[model samples]
Target: MKLHELHINDFKFFSQVEGDSPLLKIDGNHLLVYGENGSGKSTIYWALYTLLECSFKKSDDEVRKYFKKTGDESLVNIHATGTNNTYVKTILKDALGNPKTYRVSRKSSDMSIRANTDIRESNMASDFINYRVLFKLHSSKHSNKNNLWNWFLEEVFPYVKKSSDPCLIEFEALKEGPTKFLDLNGNQLFPTASLQDAPSDEEKIFYRNYRDYKQKWVTWHFWLETFLTNITTRANDLINHDFKYNFKIGLNIIKKFPTFQATDDKIKWTDPEIIISITEYEGIQNPAIKKPHTFLNEAKWSAIGLSLRFAILETRLYTADLKILVIDDMILSLDMCNRDVLLDIILNNYVNDYQIILLTHDRFFYELAKSKIAQNGIANWKYLEMFEDSSGTFPKPLIIEKTNQISKVWQLYHGKEFSMAANCLRKATEKLCNAYLSRQERINVNYSVKNLHEMLEAFRTKGMANGLNQNNLIKLIEYKNRILNPSSHYDIETPLFETELKRAIETIEALSIEANINV
Candidate 1:
C-alpha cells in the first residue's frame, strides 16, 4: 500500500480561494519535489506529517488547533476569513488497488481516524526526516552530553511495542500511568483527581495497577537497553558501508527509573536520556569522546545523525505495507561527495522498501537527482516544482507538474518559441527512435550517434517491416526536413514557420502512433 493523493485546503500557502494551488496527485509513485526557499515546499511536508500524526492524538483539538485561526502555529492561510473548510486529506491505495480516504478538519471528529487500522500502521511505518530532526541529534553543548530523551518520547516511544503485550504501545501505557487507569474492558477503575476517597476494592485495584505499571517500566527499560545496543551496531554498519566514515556511534539509553510518592496518587519517574558518544575515531578504538558535537565537523555530525536515525527506523520495523520516507533538505550540511553518497544510499537501499518523497530547495541537486533517476531507469517517479506566486494578498504556492521530453516540446511550442520547440522536437524524436530501436534490437542503443536523419531512415527501414505505413513514413521525413532540422531555421514572425512547426508536432504524433511509441 502507498499514498495515492494528498489534498489541502486553506492550509498555509494553499488557499482554495486564491486559485493557485492544485490537488497534489501522488498516483502511487515516488515523488521528487523542488521548491525554492519561501516557495511553500515545506507546507507539503507539514501537511502529510500533521495528517498522519492526528491518528495518535488524544483529542481532535490536538490536530484541529493547527488549522484554527487563533494559534501561532495555525496552518490556515493568514488571509482566509475563517477555518471552516481548512483541512488536509490523504487517499491511500491498499494492496488490491483500492483507495482508503482519511481526512482531518476543524469541524470534524477524529474518532474514526483513531479507530483506523491502516492509518495506525501507516503512522508507525512512516518516518519524517528533515534538517531540524538531524540537527536535534547533536544540538547540545559540548560540555553536556547529547540527550535525546524528549525526542524519543515524542517520536520513537509511541511506536515501540510493550514486551508483555505487543499490541500495547509504550507511549499510551506510560502516559496514563497507574492513576486514572482504564481496565481491559474500557472501564475507569478510579477517578483522575485523587483516589484518596475511593473504596477499599478500588484502592486495591490502584495498588495492583501501580505494580503492573512498574513491571512494564522495568520491561521497557530492558528492551530499550537491548534496542539501543542493537541500533548502535546497525548505525556503525551504515557508517562504515554507506557513509564510508571511520568513527562509530556509541549509544547508551539511561532508564527512567520509576519512583513512587504515596500521597500524590500517581507514579513518577526520572527523565530518560539517550546519551550519544563517539568512538573509534581515525583507526583509534574506544576513544573517550564525550562531546562529539564540539569535536567532529558538521559533515561528520550529519553523517552520524543520519545513520543513527536510519538505523533506528530499521530496527523499529523491518518492513511495513504502507511505509513512506519523506526527506526534506536533509543533506544541507554535507558536501557534494557526501550528498551523492547519501543519494546513492537512498536510491539503492530504501527505494524499493519505501515510497520515497524527496524534497529539496537546491536546483542543482534536484536536477542531479532527476538525472540519476533517469539513468537508473526508475519508471514510477514523478517530478514537481513549487513556486511562490505573490500576486495576491499573500504568497500562494504555484505547483507545476514536470514531465518528460515530448512534454517539453508542447511547453516550448505553447510559449511561442518555435526554434527552441523544433530543437526539443528533434531531441524527442531521437529519444523515441532510440526507444523503438533498443526494444527491437534487444540492445542499448547509443543516442550520441543516432542523428535525426539516420534514425528516421533506420526507423523507416525497420518500422516498415513491423507494419508502419509507407505514406506516414514519407510524411515524417518531409516534416523532419521542413521543420525539425536545425539548419532550416525560420523567423518566429513568419506564418509559414508556425504552420510547419504545428505540422512537425502532428507528424511526431503520427510517427509515435505508427511506431507504437510514446516520446
Candidate 2:
C-alpha cells in the first residue's frame, strides 16, 4: 500500500511534522516528497517501520540511541535514559480494495505499541496493493522461515517460489548446485541433483544455521516465528498485486548517451545497460544483452571500481514496478561518465515512475532530480531536505524553501546571467500556477473527497491532467538534461538573454491578468 498523508510527531529529530505525500492521483503513483536534511525524510521511512513493527539488524542500537524520546513520560525506559514515544499516522489503501489509514505510537519498550488499522478510506483505486510493512531494524524478522520480508518479493531471488500469483517466486533451488534448495512446502527444490564439489565453509555454516531456523515456530523465538510467517504470506499476496514495480533501465555507460555503444571499449563496455523493464515492456526480454541467450552473473560481489564500470546493473530488485527508489550515499566511486550514465537511467529510461527519491550529498544528482521535476512540474515532486538542527541531535528535516527545482536552480546560479535567470524563471512559475488554477476550474469529477484529497480536489486533478502538455513535457526534459550535460547552449553568458527576459515578462503579465480573472 502506498502512503498518501503522513504525520510525524515528537519523534527524535522531528518535534512535529506534517505533509501531504502528494501522488499522481489518477494512477496513485509518482509521489514526490520534498524535504532537506533532518526534515524527516528518514523519519517517514521509520514511521512505517515502527507501525509495521519491522525489526532490523541495526535497529536495536538506533532505537536505543535515537528513537528513544526526550524525557518522554509515555515511555518506560529503564535502560536508556532518553526514550520518547512518537505518534506516527499513515494513510494507506489495503487489499480487498479498501482505503485504510493506520496509526501507531512507538516507544523504547516494544510492549507499548498501539495501532489503529480500521480507519479505511471509503474510496480507493482498483489496483492498490495490500502491503503489510513488517520491518525490524537490526532484528531477526526475515531470518525466520514463516515471517515477513520486505514488501516486494515477486520474481525476487529465484530460490523463492510460489504459484498462487504470477509474481510470487519461491526460493527453491533450481539446480541443486552444491547447496540444496528448500521450498516453502516441506519438499526439495530440484530433483535432488548431485553436486561435483563440496560446499564452502560459509555455505556449510549457513546451511546448518538456516536449516534449524524455526521460521514458523511460536516458541522461545516467538517474534521470529511471527515475522517469518508474516513475510511469506505478504510476499505471496503481492504476487498478483495490481501495480507492479520495476526499474526502466539498469546502470551502464550507454545511458550517458541516448545512442547505443557509442563509447568504444571491449571488456567493461560489453557490460549491458540495465533497465527495470516492467510487465508492460514490448521490447526484447534482455535490453542490455544484445547476444542470443544471456547468463546472469551470480558470483560474489565485485570490487566497487569494476562494478561501477560495468554497464546496466540493477542495484536492487523487486516484484512490482519500483516507482520510487532511495539510494543513500551510493555511486561515490563512479567516474564522471559512469555518473552521467546513472543519471540518464534515472531520467529517460526510468520514465514510467514519476517520482525518484535519490539520497545523495552529491549536489549534482540532487539538482538532476529537481531539474526533471521542475521541468515536468512541481506536482511531480516534494523536495525533502534533511539536516541536523541546533542541538546537534541525530538530524532534523528542513523544509525545502523552494518547492520546485527551477527556483532552487535560480538561487544556485551565481554567474553573470545566472541571478537574473532565476528571477525570470520565478516569474514564469507564478504565471503557470495561475494558468493551472484557471484551467482546473472547468473540469468536474464524480468521486467524493475520500481519495480525492480535497473538496476542490478535482481542480488539482484537472490542472495536473491539462498541465501535462506533450510539448511542455519534452521541453522540460531537454531543460533537465541541459543541467546534467552543460554544453555550449547552457553557457551562463549565452546570447539567449534577450529572448528569455522578454518571455519572462510576457509570461508574468499574462499570468497576472489570468489570475485576476480567476479571483
Candidate 3:
C-alpha cells in the first residue's frame, strides 16, 4: 500500500490541516522529511504511527496519555476552543490502485476515537521503528523481552498455531497428557499387577486412561525435542544472517560474531528463552558473552538491534506487499560514515520492497541523503521541509534541486535571490572551515560555535600554522566581512548588485579549492 496523503485535525500541533493542505503529500512510497528539533517532526511521526498501527483502538485515557501535553491529557490543539473534534485521516492506494480512506476521530465527549476498520491483527505496526525503541533493544531492557518473543512467534512461526498437521497434533496430545492420568480427586492412579489379574470396572477404566496418557506423553516427548530443535535451528540461522549482514555493512564493531541458543530446563518445554552468546573457537577465543547489552558498545548494540528488527521484517509471516518502514531519527548515535552505510543498506535492500518514511533532524545527513536518493534514481520519493507556525507544523515540498552546498549557493545567486544566496554562502564557508580544521587535526578548534565569523577566525588561527593557504584564508575572511556578514545580519537600503554577488561567490569557490574541498 502507498500512502498518498495524510490529514490531521486538532491533533497535537495540527489544528486543522486537510484537503490540499495535507500534512504530508506522498509521492510514490518514499518520503524524506527534514525538520529542526521541536518543530513537530515527531508529531507527524506519531501521527502516521497512530494511523497505520490502528492505535485509535486504545482507550481514551491511554491515547490521551500518549498524546498528552504538559502533563495533561489533551491531544487537541492548545489553540483549539471547546468541543472541537480531533482526528487523523489517511488515504492509501492498494496494489491494484484502489484508494481507501481511513479516519480516526474523537469528539470532546468521547474518550477514544473510532476507526473504520480493525487492524489490531495486522503486523504492520511492528515495522514502526525509532531511536527510543532501538535504545531499548540496545540496552536489553526487560520490558522489551515479551515484545521480542511475540515478534518472533507471530512473524516467524505464524503458521505453527493454525496447523493441525501430525506434528502439531502430537504436540497437543503431549500438552494434554498430564491431565489424563489424574483421578477425579486429582490423585494419581496406578495400573494392576498383571494383565491376567481381574480388575474392577473403575480400576479397568483407570488402567485404560493411564495407558493412553503414558502413550501420549511418550509421543509428546518425541515431538518436543524435534520442535525445540527446529526452533533452535531457525533462531541460529536468523542470528547468523543478522550478524553477517551487519558486519558486512560496517555496523558491527565486535571481534566475534554472536550466535543464538534456545535454552530451558530439560523437562520445561512450555517456556524457553533465547540466549545470544559469542561464538567461540579454540582456547584463545573471546569470552562467551550472553548479554550483548553488557559486553557490546553502544554502536555495536545499536547495530544488533537494527539487524534484529530488519531480520524480523524480512521473515514476516505475510508477504511484503503492504509493508511500511518508519525510521525516525535512528542514527543520532552513529557517526556520519556509519550513517551513510546504514542508508545504503536500507535503500538497496528495503526501499523498493517496502514503503519508507525516513525522518531526520540532522541537516547534513538530510542533504547527503537527498542527494543519495536522487542518485539512486528513485522517482517516487518526495523531499519535504517541515516547520511550525502559529497554525501548527506544516510540510512543504522542497523543490530546489541543488544537491551540494556550493551548488545551492550558486543556484540562489543566479536566480537573483541575493539574500538567500548570502545565507547559503555563510553556511558553505562554515562547512568548509569545519572540514579544514578537522582535517588539520586541530583539537582546540571549537566545533560548537554557531557564528560564521568566529568559526572562520578560529579556523584561521589554528590552521595558519598548519598547511592552510594564507592567501585564500585572508580572501575568505575579507569577503565575509565585506558582503556575507552584512547581507545576513542587517538590512541595506540598496540590494547587492549581480557583480558584487558574483565576486563573493568567486572568493568562496577559490577558498574551497585551496582548502581541497569540492564545491
Candidate 4:
C-alpha cells in the first residue's frame, strides 16, 4: 500500500498542517519519510499507525504524550488534540489505481455520548485525552472496520478469512521446520477492534462501512533467516492475530523452536548485517537470483536509501490503490554503490505498483530521486521541502523545485562513485559558469520567482524544440507555487500524472540501459 498525500491538524508539533507536501514526485512502490531525529517526521508515521490501529514496536512514552485529549466534545470525535479540535485526513491509492480518503476529527470540549451521539467517535475522541491515538484500524481509513472486512472477503481476497489463508499458514515440513508464513500471510494481514454497538446514523454511515471491523488484514512478513537455513517456525498457538505479531525468530531459534522459550521480553531480528529484499525469502540469498526484492550488497550511500525507499514507492504510486509509505531515513546507513543499486531497483521494479511519500535530512537522497525522474523527462514526481522558523506556528513542509537541481543531482548520483554525481554536475555548473564568464557581455536585472516564472513562460511560448513539452514545462514552473499554496485531492482526478511520470521514468531509464548503463 502507498500514501499519496496526508493532512494533519492539532496533532503534536503540527498545529494545523493541511498543505504539507512531499519533497519529490514519485510513482514507485516505496515511500520514505525522511527527517532528523527530532523533526517530527515520525509523527506522520504515527498518524497512520493510529488510524489503522497498528502497533509499532518502537514508540516510547515520550512520543505518546504528544497525541492526547484536549479538544472537542462532540458525538463523533477523533483523538482530542491539545491543539484545537484536530483533523487528520490521509489519501491512499489502492492496488488497482483507485483512490480513497480517511479522516478523523474531534469537537472542542464538553463531550457527549447521547443516543443521537456516536459512542465510537466519542471513544475515539476520549482516546485523544488518554494519550496517543493509535489506529489498529480497518484495512483502510474514511470508513469503519466491518464494511472493510466485508469488501476484503467479498472482493479483494476472501481467502484471508480462514486460518489458512487470511492467517499466516505454516506447514509441519522439513527435519526442523523453520517458521515460515506461506500461503504466506503475515504483515500483509492484520486485525481490528471488536466494536460493541453500531454507531448512530451519521457514524453508521462512515464507521459501519469499514472492512477491518469484522474482517482481517494480512501480508507476508519482511525478514528472513540468513545465517541459518532449513529452519522451522512453530504453529499459530503463540501468534497474536489482532496486532499481527510474528514469532521472534532469533530468540525462538536459540531458546524454544522445539517448544521455544524466550529469555527476553523484547525481541528483534538477529542479523545485523542481513539486508531485506521484499521480493522473496527463498531466492534472494543466491547472487544468481533475480527478483524485485533482491538482497544487494552494492549501492551508493549518498543515494542508496533514497533508491530502496523509492523503488517500492514507485510501484505503489502507479499500481496500488492504497498508497501510504512512512520511512525514517532507512538508507542513511549505506554507501554510494549501494545507493545507486538501490535507485536502479526502484526505477526498474517498484514504480509500476505504488505511490510514495518520503523524508530525508540528506540532500543527496532528495537530489537522487528527482534526477532519476526528471532527467528521464518524468513529470509525475514533485519535491517537498521542510523547515522550521520561530515566526511560524509549527514546522512546515513545502514543495519546491526548479531547473530541478535536486532531481538532476539525484539522476547524476545513480551509479555514481563517491564524487561522481558531483563531478557530472559540472555541466550544469558550466551553465552557471558560462553565464558568469559572459556576465560582462550582457545581463538581466534581477533574481526572483517573478522573473524566473516569466523566463520559463517565455521559453514555453517558443515550444518543445527549445526545452520541454507544454505540460511538463508548465508543471516545472508551477511546482513551487502548487506545494506552497496547497490543493485538494479532488483537483487531481487521475493518477495519469503519476502514470505519465512512471512511463517517463521508464523511458529515461531505457536510455541509460540502452547505452549500457545497467539501469
Candidate 5:
C-alpha cells in the first residue's frame, strides 16, 4: 500500500497538523525526511507505528507498552488543553486504488483504534523498521531468550510452522498421551493401574498402552534431534544470504564473510530457543578456540545484524503488491562507501516497488540521498524538514528548485548580510561541485573539506574535458580560492567584501549553468 498522508494530532511533539487535505502528502511513494535530534523525527516514526498497530488490531495496553510510556496521559501532548483528543490518522491506497484510513486515538485514560473502513486486520507490520528494533537485533547483550530472533524467523518464514514432519507428530502424541486418560484427580490413572499386582483386564490394557507410550517417548527423543538439525539448516540458509550481501558490500570494512549458526545443538519442540554464533572467516579457517563474539569489531557486527534484518524483510516483502519500508537512522554505523552502496540498493532494487520512508539526522546523508534519488528519475519524491517550535513540532516540505541556493545567496547579499551571504555562496559552490561530480557518477567523495577539494578538481576536469569555456573554469577556481576556501576555514585570512561576495556568487551561478549542473 502507498501512504498518501498522515495526520498526527497531540501524539508527541506534534500537537495538531490538520488540513482540509492530507497534511503529509507523499507524491511518488518515496519520502526523505531530515530533522535534528529531538526534532520529532522519531515522533513521526512512532506515529506511523501507532497507525500500524491500529491496522493490526493491537491492544491499547500493548501499544502503550511499546511506546514505553504509562497511561494515555503520557501519550497526549504535554501542551494539550482540555478535551483535545490525541490521534494519528493515516490515509493509504491499496493495490486496487481504493483509499483506506486508519486512526488511533487517546483521551485522558481511554485509547481506541479504528482500522480500515471495514475494520479488517492487517499483517503489514513486518514491513516497518526503526532504530529500536534494529538495535535490539544488533545488541550483543541478548541471549537465547531474545524475542527479536523468534519474531524474525516467524515473519520471514511463516510456513515453517506448517511443516508436517512425522517427528513432530510423534512429539505431539507424546505430550497428549497422559492427558488422553487422566482421572478425575488429574492423575494418570492408567499408568498407575499398570503397576498394580492383581491387575484386571482393564489394567492389562492400560499396561499395553503405557508400554506403547514409553516406546513413542524414546522415538521422539531420537527424532527431535533430527528435527532441530533440519531447522538449523533452514536458518543458516536464510542467514547466509544476508551475510553474503553484507560482506560483499561492506568489504571495505570487513575483511572476510562471517558464518552464523544456532548456539545450541538441541532445540525444544515447542517455542525453540535460538542464539546465534557469528564466526569470522579467519576464526573458521584457523580453527580458533575463541568465542564467536570475539571475532569481529562492533561495526562489522552491526553491519551483519542490520543486513540480516534487511535480508529477511526483502525476502518476504519483495513479493507483496503493496509494501511500506520505514527506515530510521539505520546507517549510522556504516562508513561512507557502504552507505552509498546501501542507498543504491534501496533505490534501484526497492524504491520502484515499495513506498520507502527514510528518516535521518545527518544533513550530509540527507543531501546525498536527495541528489541520488533525483538522479534515479524519481521526480515526485518529497523532501521534508522536521523541527520543533514553541507550540509543537511541524513538518515543512523542502522544495527542490534549480537555483535555490544561488537565489538565497543573492537575496542575502542584497539584504546587506554580507557574512551570511558569503557563507551561502561558499555552500552553493560546494553543492554545485558535488552535484556535478554526482552527475558523472563519482559518488565516493566523503563529506569533508579535503574531499570537497577533490570534488572541485573532479568537476573542473570533467567540465574542461567536455569543452567548457576556459574563462568559466578560471572564474570557478577564483571563487573557490578567494571565497569558498577562506570561508570554510577561520584560520585563512582571505579578505571578503560585498563586491567580492557578489562576484563569487555570480561566478558559481554562471558556471552552474555553463556546466549544465543547474538542476
Candidate 6:
C-alpha cells in the first residue's frame, strides 16, 4: 500500500479559506519536496508522522490533544479560531486497487486505531529520519564516550524483534520488567518466606525463580550481542561500498545486571548502553580509534550515524502493506559528493521498496536531484516546492506542485480546459527548444524575434545533427502544424479536439525525453 493523497486543513502553516488550500495528489508515486527554511517543509513531515503516531495511541484524548485549539503539542494554526477545525487526512491504496481513507481529527479519534491492524502495521513498517535524529547519534561531549542507550530504547528497540521468536520485543520486554521472576506456567512468582524458615517446596521454588531471573538477563545480553554484531557488519559494508570510506564501525553492548529487592516488589537496574568505536584502515593495517566523535569530522560522523540507523531500519522492516521513507534534510552536513552518493543509494536501492518522501531546503541539491531523476527516466515521481506566503494576516505555505510547464499542461488538460492546455503545451515546446539553443550557444540577437516556426526549424536542424530522435522531431512538426501554428500565430478559430490536444501534449513530453531536456 501507498499514500494516495494528503490533505491538510488549519494545521500549522496550512490555512483553509473557503477550500482554497490545495491537496497534495500523490497518486501513489514518490514525492520530492524543496522548500526554503521556515517555508512549512517540515510541516509535511510532521503531518505524516503525527497521523501514523495516532494509530499507536490507546485513548481518543491522546489523539485529540494534538488538534485542539490549546495545548503545548497542538499543531493548530495560530490564526485559527475555535470555529476552525484542524485535521489531517490521507488516502492509502494497495495493489488490489482499492483506496482506504484514514483521518485524524478532534472527533475522528473515536473511530479507534487499536482495532485496525493495517494502520498499526504500517506505522511499524515505515521509517522517519531527520537531521535531529542524526544529531542524536554523535552529539556526545569529547571527554564522554558515545553511548546510544536512550536513543536505542526510544527509537530502535521498539521496531526490532528477536529472530527466535517474532512476538518477543526488546522494548516491550524491558518496559514490563522481564527480569522479574516468573513460574513455569508464565505466572509471576514471589518468595513467601526466608530460606531458613520456609517449607522445602517453597524454598525450592524460590531458588528456581532466582536462577530463572538471572538467566533472563543472560538471554537478553546474548540477543543484544547478536544484534550489535549484525549491525556492525552491515554498517561497515555500507561505509566501505556506498560511502567509499576507509573506516569500520565497532559496537559493544554494556550489559547492566538487574538487582532484586528482598520484598520482591521493586526491581531496579540501569539501562544497557552501546559504546561505539572506530577502526581506520591504512594500506591493510588497522588503527584503533577510541574516541570517534572527537577524532572524526562532522561529515564522517554523520555518515556513521546514518549508516547505523539505516542498518537498524533494514532489520526492522518485516511485513506491512504501506512502507514510507520520509527524510527531512538529513544530509545537510555532508559535502556534495557524499550527498549525491546518498541520493543515489536512496534512488537506486530503496525507491522500489518504499514510497519515498524526500524534503530538502537546498536549491542546488534540489535541482541536481531532479535532473538525476529525469535522466534516470523515473516517470512515477512528483517534484514540489514550498514557500512561506505572508500576503494574509498570518503566514501560510504557498506550495507549488506543478512548477514545470509539462506538468502544468497535464493539470489543465485533466481539468477539461483545452485552450489553456494548448497554450501551456506550446510554451513547454518553446522552452524545450530555447534550452537546446542556449546549451549549444547558437542564439544570436535575431533569436529574440523568431517565432514558433523558426524555432522548430532551427531545433530540428541542430537537434538531428546532435543525435536527437528524428521520429519525435517529425511528431513535433506535425503537432505544431495541426494545433500550435494556426491557433497561436494566425489567431484562427481552430476547434481543439481532446484527443488531438492530448496527443500533442504527449508528443512534447516525448520530445523532451528524446532531446534530454531538463531545467
lDDT of each: 0.73, 0.34, 0.56, 0.34, 0.55, 0.74
Residue 161 Cα positional deviation in candidate 1, in Å, after optimal superposition: 5.8
Model 2 whole-model lDDT (C-alpha atoms): 0.34
lDDT of 5: 0.55
Clashes of each: 0, 79, 1, 118, 1, 0
lDDT of 3 by residue, 1-519 (tens): 677877777677666544446666674458887766665676677776675444334355555453444356556667656355567766777768787666655533333233322333233323666766565454354433322443333333332322222234454444433332343556553332231243545444555544565576555444444543444444344334433322221111111111211121112234224444444322334455444445556665555555555554554444422456778897876756557766876787788677788888888888888889889987677766554332213432222333467887776665555666777787888778778765444333564444677667877776587666777667767778766775444543245545666787887787777768875
- lDDT winner between 3 and 5, please give it: 3
- Least well predicted 10-residue stretch by lDDT in candidate 6: 164-173
- Write the candidate numbers in order of decreasing lDDT: 6, 1, 3, 5, 2, 4
Highest-TM-score candidate? 6
Model 6 regions lying over 4 Å from their true place? 17-22, 108-110, 141-143, 154-217, 263-267, 283-286, 403-519
Report how far residue 294 has shifted in candidate 2, in Å.
Answer: 25
For model 5, the superposed segments whose C-alpha errors exceed 4 Å read 19-21, 58-73, 94-98, 107-122, 141-272, 278-290, 315-322, 390-519
Regions of model 4 farther than 4 Å from truth: 1-4, 17-42, 53-66, 69-83, 92-99, 105-320, 375-379, 393-519
- C-alpha displacement of 92 in model 3, angstroms? 1.8
RMSD (Cα, Å) for all candidates, in order, is: 8.5, 19.6, 12.2, 20.3, 11.3, 9.2
lDDT of 2 by residue, 115-190 (tens): 2112211110011111111112112222332211331232121112122211121121211122234434444432
Which has the greatest lDDT? 6
Error of 2 at 139 (Å): 24
For 1-519, candidate 6 gives per-residue lDDT tens digits of 888889888888777644523368888999999888988898889888888778767688888888898989899888899587787878888878798887778876435653467777777778888877566655553447668676676556655656523223443454344334444556664432243354555345566445555576688788789898998899888888898888887888887776554545656767778887765564344466657778888777777777877887787655777899899998776787778887887888788888999999998988888988988887789888776665457777766676678886776666555665677688898898888875434454755556787788888888789888787787788888766754553432244477778888887888787778852
TM-score of each: 0.70, 0.35, 0.55, 0.38, 0.56, 0.72
- Summarize candidate 1's per-residue lDDT along 1-519 as a digit string, tens digits: 788888888888778642323379888999999998888898888888888777776676677788788888788877778835788887888778887778877766644675466666677778787877565554544345577666666544554544322323564566456555554456655333234444556454466555666677677777778887887898898888888888887878766555554444555656678887777888988897767778888777777767767876685463445788898998677788778877887888788878999999998999999988888887799998776665456677766677866676675566565776798788888877888785444332653465567778887878788887777777778878778778888565588998888877877777787777878
